[model samples]
Target: MTTWVLLRGLAREARHWGGFPDKLRCALPAGDTVVALDLPGNGALWRERSPARVEDMVAAARRTLAGVPHTPPYALVALSLGGMVALQWALEHREEVRGCVLINSSLGRFSPFWRRLRPASYATLLRLLAPGRAAIDRERAILRLTSNLPLAEGTQQAWTAYALEAPVSRGNALRQLKAAALFRAPAAAPGVPLLLVASERDRLVSVECSRAMARHWGAPLRVHPAAGHDLALDDPGWLAGLVADWKTRVS
Candidate 1:
């Protein structure tokens, strides 16, 4: 049985994944397991200082799982900045990474800064950059930028509460962003199995980033025609289904 690890993006915690982890678990084989981990400075580990480099983040993740019951090599399913950490993990510790599914992620080596983080999102992103913004307002701005589809009732309120309970420090948020901005994937594809997933309507990041990564890495690519950057929030079922089908091939 495979052990699947879920990782979220910049300034986000495992809680941001909402119900997607459970949905994915249901889609997988009965014996398989799913574990959602919080990067340093986010979720349960919010008190820890976030590393400014992606490689350091990988080290932190390895440390987080050390001596845990779950076994490696792990199937890493990650989003945005988490994707960068997964790629670096596979490259640095190939034996411990069984496979990777990078969603709505980009590589500095393959895409320009503008496309990596679209110009259209600059305003919304800037609003979130303001320190001391109310949790509900911040979450609302994030939702506007990341999701194009209708949300479930109370989604916004719940996200607001999550923000208040385990708020990401402004310094930590900037450090995470710096890591994401500086990370450059190796020119060669990672040795492990890989998949690239993108959202056609993503307002924050250009879809071409994923396409470029797929072409450069010679990996399979899947696109959701209407999903936004938060594909899990927009359509968890579709993401889960794709992972289920891809798991069979990779396994």
Candidate 2:
């Protein structure tokens, strides 16, 4: 059986993938399995201290995979902060990964605004901007910052609920922010097949960043018009079909 492992972004839980696995299972050929993982310090692993670096997260993922019945050679599909972890995994364990899909993420934090801000300043800004009740009310703003999709009523509600239920702690959020600011792609690219998916309207990581990674890795690219950073949630069917088609073409 073929396995596809889905990884979510920083402070996000496995549930963030939402209906994506089911949609992909329906779309993918028989014998393919979709596995959604909860990174350390988030979701099912929330009790753990969020790792400060990509290497620690990679180690946790490796340990998680080790518990699975199947071994190595899986497709990795990751988003945002998860994409960073996925990229590092593929770089260090290329032999274990058959394919990789990085969605709405950059090799490094793309914004000069973010890069210029000191970690303390960034953390303060984030905390100040993300106040209670107001945070829920600012769903559109949050979506704009986090995803490439236009905010719909349902999307807003769902995201707000997620934020309320699994609020990433300030410390963890700051750690992730710092990590993003400092991150850089490895000198050597992975040998496995790669797909770079970007949201044209993404306010977080610019589409140009995705394009750069694609160019650097010689990976195929897919751009979703008007889709915000959370492309999978916005249109899981589209993403599933794209992955299925890529699997067929690559096979």
Candidate 3:
């Protein structure tokens, strides 16, 4: 059985993936398994201090996965900051990773800072730092910045609940940001197979980041015509289908 590891980005936790994991599980082969992991200082690991380096994040993730009953040589599906960690993992432990799929991810060496994280999102990101901001408002602002399509009716409420249940401290948030900012992927691609997925209408991060990485790595890229940075949330069925197809070809 192939084990699929799902990693979310930034201050987001596994719960933020919502129904996407289930959708992917169904889309993959029946015996395949999906595991969603929370990075340090997020979700179930909220009390932990976030590492300032992406490599440390990879180490922490490996520690967490050691507890799970999964086989080696897993497929990694990561988004945003988690993508950096995934890249590091593949580089550090080539034998343990079979393939990687990065969604809306950017590297420092690939694109400019403005393109990596669009200026349009700076205000919302800054406002989120204000004290006493309600969870619903924070989640709403994030949704507005990251999603191009309308979400489910209670998406705000559910995300707010996630925020309240496992709040990521501001310090941890900054640490994670630092990790992302400092990370620089190798000029050469990792030895394993890679797939880069991007959104043409992303508001938070420029699609060019993925485009540039794909060109540099000579990896295959699939662009969503209307999705946002949160491609899985915007069009999970499509993402699932694309992954299913790619996995079939690579496997």
Scored against the true structure, residue 71 in model 1 reaches a CA lDDT of 79
Q: List where candidate 3 sits over 4 angstroms from the true fold.
A: 131-133
Ranking by lDDT: 1, 3, 2
Residue 70 of model 1, lDDT score: 85
The whole-model C-alpha lDDT of candidate 1 against the native structure comes to: 0.91
Off by over 4 Å in 2: 109-141, 147-155
Give the C-alpha miss distance for residue 245 in model 1, angstroms: 0.6
Q: Give the runs in model 1 whose Cα sits over 4 Å from its true position.
A: none
Candidate 3 has an lDDT of 0.91
lDDT of each: 0.91, 0.74, 0.91
TM-score of each: 0.97, 0.85, 0.98
Which is better, 1 or 2, measured by TM-score? 1
Q: Write the per-residue lDDT of candidate 3 for residues 195-241, one digit (tens) a residue.
A: 99999999988999999999999999999999999998889999999
**Total backbone collisions for each predicted model:** 0, 7, 0
Q: Which lDDT value does model 1 have at 197?
A: 96
Ranking by TM-score: 3, 1, 2
